[model samples]
Target chain A: MLTVKKASRLFKDGAAGFKNITFTVQKGEIVGILGTSGCGKSTLLRVLSGLDHADSGTIHLNDGSPSGAGVIFQEPRLMPWLSVEDNVLFGFKNPSKYRKQAAHYLSLVGLSEFAGALPRDLSGGMAQRTAIARALASQPSVLLLDEPFSALDAFTKMQLQDLLLDIWQEEKTTMVMVTHDIDEALHVCDRVIVLSGQPGEIAAEFKISQPKPRSRSDLSLATYKEKIFSILEYSNTGLQKYSVR
Target chain B: MKSKLNLIGLGMILPVLLIAIWEAAARLGWIESYLLPAPTVVIESIIEMAQEGTLWAHVSITLYRVGAGFLIGTAAAVFIGAAVGYFKKAEHLLDPILQAFRSIPSLAWVPLFLLWMGIGEPSKVTLIAVGVFFPVYLNIVSGIQGVDRKLIEVGKVYHFNSLQLVRRIILPASLPSFLVGIRSGLGLGWMFVVAAELLGASEGLGYLLVLGQNTSSPELIIASIILFAALGKGTDALLKSIESRSLKWQDNLQNAQ
Candidate 1:
């Protein structure tokens, strides 16, 4: 479980990106944060993952601190110099026991055959899968993804999405995925939060009220996708214009 | 198989062509037999030197100096480079002075070294050590710096402390550079060894070169030059084999799956 109370990230005492933002993501629930390109979606994810700190707010997370939270960037960020297995096992301090776990994750991502392959050899989708594998290898309690699959083709993206849903279901980990794709949000997330405009704050939150393993072709998902797009359109048109320097 | 023969053809053609031209020139008096002896004359001089066993004596002394100077110089370079690359304080303090010193050629230190240490093995070794230093240092520094920042971020995320960062990340990243430096240092060692020997040493290939000048034979000088060139090439080949083996992981990571 995670709770954010008035979370505002002000970089350099200038304009705050996220302002008075308050929301709670239930344990084992995948929440998608949808927003415009310049909105604080990635920044929010970074803050949650402890890569960047919240300027002011109480971010209450499970266990000790947010430092242990696993993070996957937009890029695969796998070390090009290491093999696929080695890259997967990078976070594992105990390679003897955890090396098998790396292999397991490699198989989990259907990359068991390419365990010897380097990052450069991987396709965009495959490399992102490896990045996902690397994140899961840490056995994270809370996984934060920052537009992690924006680079993939539609087919590979769907496959990875299914893989992620399977992992999330099995592990029951708290997942916060930031994405611009509304269909993706409706497909995987238990709740969808829309952040509005530049220097964004949470404008609307929607609980899917739908059951697990939701299908995109489902009528409910199609309706939710329309609702999400309209919510974004309304938020953008309604947002107050202010000069940001 | 056909391409292999072409490699062989290219190799055989150049030397055979050079030797034939050299033999012709000596016979035609286009080049003096004494000043620039034919290849055969140099071979005969090598036979004579072998008969007397004096060739090995000179060769042994040169090898000893080269080995001693190389080891000392390479060790210093690797250590100093790692220190400068890893520590901010060390870099700020040592870099400028090292840079100033590096600007002076290794041979430039010979006069000062000889004045201080005399025309002994110490001065000779000192010259070679200084020569070997900068290439290793610069290569190591650049290699460590060249390590992809993203790779370091992986370490940072894992909470690798400073010591572990150097051991797991910096050292491995800098090793290829360090090895290249050592190989090039060995090359520089030959220059210092022979130059020092030419100036003062009683034995060695360079001593033979100077001796030929005294006797005005040129054949013994040519033989010494060939011996030195062959030694340099052989050592380089040996280092290349070691480099290729040691960096196999990197090669696989880069080229293959």
Candidate 2:
């Protein structure tokens, strides 16, 4: 579980990244932070993963271990020099000890056949899957994904979404994903938090309450989609008004 | 494998044909023998040197100097380059001096090195070291600086400490450029040997070149020149093999494309 209280970050050029952002994620929950471009979603994820600092406020991990966080970037970001298996084992102090766990994670991501393959030799989908496997192999209590599937094609994105759902169900690991896609947020996440405006702040939060393996075309998701769309539209208009004034 | 062999064979045709033409032109007296010695005469000089055991002696000495200087220079460059690259303070302190030195030609260092170290092996080795140092140092620094910041973030996210990050991410990411530096440094290392031996004692292929000039034997000069070419090619081939092997991952991706 993670708790962030009134977190804020400001750029050196005096622009705010995010302001007074407060949220708590429970254990094994899949939460999606939805935002448009420049809404500081990725910045928030970076702060949560401890890759960057917050200028103000605090993030406390109730899990007690700081190493419990594993992050997957928008890009796969695999080490080009390493084999798929080695990449999965990259975070381990002694890789050989966790060799079986790495293999298992690779299989979980459906990339066991590519254990010896280099990152460059993989397709985009395969590379992202390998990245997911790498994150899982570290056995993090919280997996933070920053727009992980946005670069992927729609078909591949759908497959990855399903795979993520499966992994969350099976592994029971908490996940906080930053995404721009409304349907993607509806499709995969147990809860969705929308961020909006300049110097972004959390605008709305919605709990899906839909059962696992929910359909993209399901009538239940359409209303949630419409609500998220209106929130985005209102935020855009608000920004336009502020800029014009 | 077969295609690779065919490509090599195709590459050899021009060189082989040129050698034949030179041999024929020499035999036909198209050029005077003293001015441009016959290919056969060059071969004979090589055989004569080999018989006298001086050929191996010179080769061994030159190889030893190149090997020693190259190893020392490359090791120092990697260390200093990594230091400067990883620390802002190191870069601030050392980069300006290095950049200034980088503009000075390798041969220009020879006179100063000789004056300081004396006209001995130390001077020769130091000249070669200076020649080998800059390329490796500059390339390593640039290579480390150019590594993707995203990859460094991944390292940080994974809880890698500074040393672990450098060892796992920084070094391997910069390896391709570092190898390039090694290849170029070795080339300069060979070139500096001539400058080193030009003023010095009585060993190495460069020494043989001076001996050829003193004795007025065109055959000796040609033979020494040929040996330089052969040795340069041989050592380059060794580094090339290492480069290709270490960069096999990149090659696999290219092949897939």
Candidate 3:
């Protein structure tokens, strides 16, 4: 479980980045932070990953600490000098001790054949998969994904989405993902939190309630999609009060 | 493998053609052989010196000066460059003064070093080290500064301390640039050794150059020049191989082709 209370990390006289945002995520739930470009989605994720500090307010994981969040950025960001397996073990202080775990996660992400290969040798999808394996190998309390599959082709993106759900089913890992893709958010997340406007704040939160193995072509999802599209379009008009859930 | 051999064969064409032309001109007496020896005459002079055993003595001492200076210069550069690169405060304090020193034309340090350390091996080695320092230092600073911030963020998410970040991330990330610096530094070391020995030493390939001038042996002069070229190219090739091996992970234009 994770909680962010009144978190704000704005810049340039509050014209950029997120402000006064608040949210919580339950254990084993996949929550997607949906927003357009420049909505400070990344800024919020940085705060959650502990890479940057919130200018005000607080973020606490289950034990009242901010340490156990693993992040998968939009780019693979793999260490070019390291092999795929070594990149997975990068979070560990003693990598040799976690060799087995690295292999397991590599296999989990379908990258077992790439263990000895450098990041350069991998295709974009494979490289991103390696990054996912890397984050999983660390065994973080919560995994924070900042548009992890946004750069991939549609088929690779869909495959990874399904792979992500499979991992969720097996590991029950809590996740907080920031993404601009509406369908992607709908596909993988248990809950979707829409953020909008300059100095972004939460605009709406929707609980999918749809069971696992939900169909993308399902007419029910189309209704939710249309509703989300209206809220996103409306948010673009001007800064407005956050609508009631 | 065949392509690699073909590339080498392509590279040899110009040098071989030039050498052949030089031999023809000298043998035909189109140029005064005493003033500009034929390539064969240079080779013969080299062989004569080798038979006399003085060739190895000069070559060994020159090799020693370059090797010592390279190690000393590279070590100092790595230490100081890493410091200046990693810490903003150190960069602010140190970089301006270092850049100023770098611009002074390292040859200007010769007289001062000679005055302080005298005509001993120390002066020669120190001069070579000074020559070797700047490129390595500059490359290292840029290399560390250029490490992708995103990768450093990855380290930060893992809660890596400053030392761990530098050791595991910064060092390896900057290694390609560091090696580039080292290759160039070795080149400058050879250059300065010639200057150092030309001004002070009793032996070394540069001394061979001086000996030819004083005794009017154009063959010896050409021979020493040829040896300098051979040794310089040999060392550079060695470093290039190392660079390619270590940077095999790079997904750059070179690897793509």
Candidate 4:
């Protein structure tokens, strides 16, 4: 489990980052942080991932280990010189000890054939899959994803979303993802927390009780999409009373 | 691979053509042989030197100086450049003075080095080392500083310590630049060796140039110049091959070609 209390990380006149945010993620739960651009979604994730320090609050991880969480950035960020398998094992203190697990992780992401190939040889989707394998190989208590699939084409994004769900079903790792894609947030997350405005604060939170293997075009998701759209519109328009009815 | 051979053949065409023209003109007595020797006459002079066994001694000694100087210079550059590149404090402390030293022509050190160390092997080698040092050092510093920040963040997420970060990320990330530095350094090393030999030497190709001048043998001078050209190109080609092999992972236009 992870908990953040009254966390504020602001920059440049105190209006460019997240402010006073409080949230908790339970074990094996998938939580999504959704927002429009410039709403400090990434800043909140950075604070949670401990890449950046919060100016006003504390983040507590259950294990109290600095390596307790693994992060997948928007870009694959693979070491070009490393082979796919070596990249999977890159996070381990002693890579040779976990050498066998690298194969498993690569297979999980369907990159078993590419284990010996350099990152330069891989396509964008393949590279991102290799990144997923790398994060999973660490076997961290919590996985933090910062728009991991945003750079992919629509088909690859949907495939990766399903792949993510499959991994969740198997490993049950706690995940906290930051995304701007409303449909994606609704699809894979157990709960989506919406942040709005400059120096972003939580505007609303929606809990989806739907089980796994839900259809992408389900009527239920469409209704939820409508609500999230209006909420995002309201926040983005900001007090200019315009009828979007 | 076949294309590479063709490329080599393509490069030799102009030089061969020019040599043929000069040889033809010399045979027809179209020019003064004393002023400019024919390519064959230069080749004959080189063969005569080789027959006397003096050519081997000169070539070997010059090779030794260049090799020793290159290694020493590169080792020092790696040490100092890594420190300057990694530590902000080190950069602030050392970079200004190093930059100032860099701007001075390396040849400017020749007279002072002779004065300090005497007109001996030490002075010659040290001058060559100084010439080799700057390119390698500057390249390393820039290479380390230019590493992608996003890659460093990945290391941080894994909780890598400073040393681990450098070993796992920084060193490998900057390797291409390091190789580039050494190639240019080797070039400067070749140039400085000639300067070193020209100033004070009993042997070597540069000494042969001086010998030819004193004896008024235009063929000998031409032969020594040819040897210098061959040696410089040969060493550069060796370094280039090493560079290409190590940097096979790069996604660049050269690889596409």
Choose the strongest candidate by TM-score: 2
TM-score of chain B of 1: 0.92
Candidate 3 chain A, which ten residues in sequence have the lowest lDDT sum? A236-245
Lowest summed lDDT over 10 consecutive residues: which window, candidate 1 chain B? B248-257
List, residue by residue over A180-220, the lDDT tens digit for candidate 1.
98888888888999988657888788899888787668896
RMSD of each: 3.4, 1.6, 2.9, 2.4
Over B1-257, each residue of candidate 2 has an lDDT whose tens digit, in order, gives: 99999999999999999999999998999988878888889999899889999899999999988988998899899999999999999999999999998898778877788789898788888888888999999899999999999999989988888999999999999999999999999999999888788788688999988998998888888899999999999999999999888887774553454
Model 1: DockQ score:
0.34
- Model 4, B1-257: lDDT tens per residue? 99999999999999899999999999899989988888889998889889999999999989989999999999999999999999999999999999999999999998999999998899989998999999999999999999999999999988899999999999999999999999999999999999999999999888888998999899988888889899999999998998888888899987775
- Candidate 2 per-residue lDDT over residues A1-245, each given as its tens digit: 88999999867453558889999999989999998898888889999989889999999887744467989988999999999999999888888798899889999999999999999889999999999999988778899999999999999999999999989888988999999999998998999999997778999999999987898889989999999999999999988898899
Q: What are the runs in model 3 whose C-alpha is more than 4 Å off?
A: A63-67, A239-245
TM-score of chain B of each: 0.92, 0.95, 0.97, 0.96
Docking class of 1: acceptable
Write one digit per residue (lDDT tens) for candidate 3, span A1-245.
89999999989899889989988999989999999888899999999988889999999888433449889999999999999999999888899998899989988999888899989888999999999998888788899999999999999999999999989989998999999999999989999999988889898999999987678787888887898888888877655454331
After superposition, candidate 1 runs with Cα above 4 Å error: A16-21, A58-60, A64-67, A230-245, B27-29, B248-257
> In each prediction, how many residue pairs overlap at the backbone (N, C-alpha, C within less than 3 A)?
0, 0, 0, 0
For each candidate, the DockQ is 0.34, 0.77, 0.77, 0.78
State what share of the real interface contacts each candidate retains: 0.16, 0.77, 0.90, 0.71
Candidate numbers, best lDDT first, in rank order? 3, 4, 2, 1
What residue pairs are clashing in model 1? none
Query: iRMSD per model?
Result: 3.0, 1.2, 1.2, 0.8
Clash pairs, model 4 backbone: none
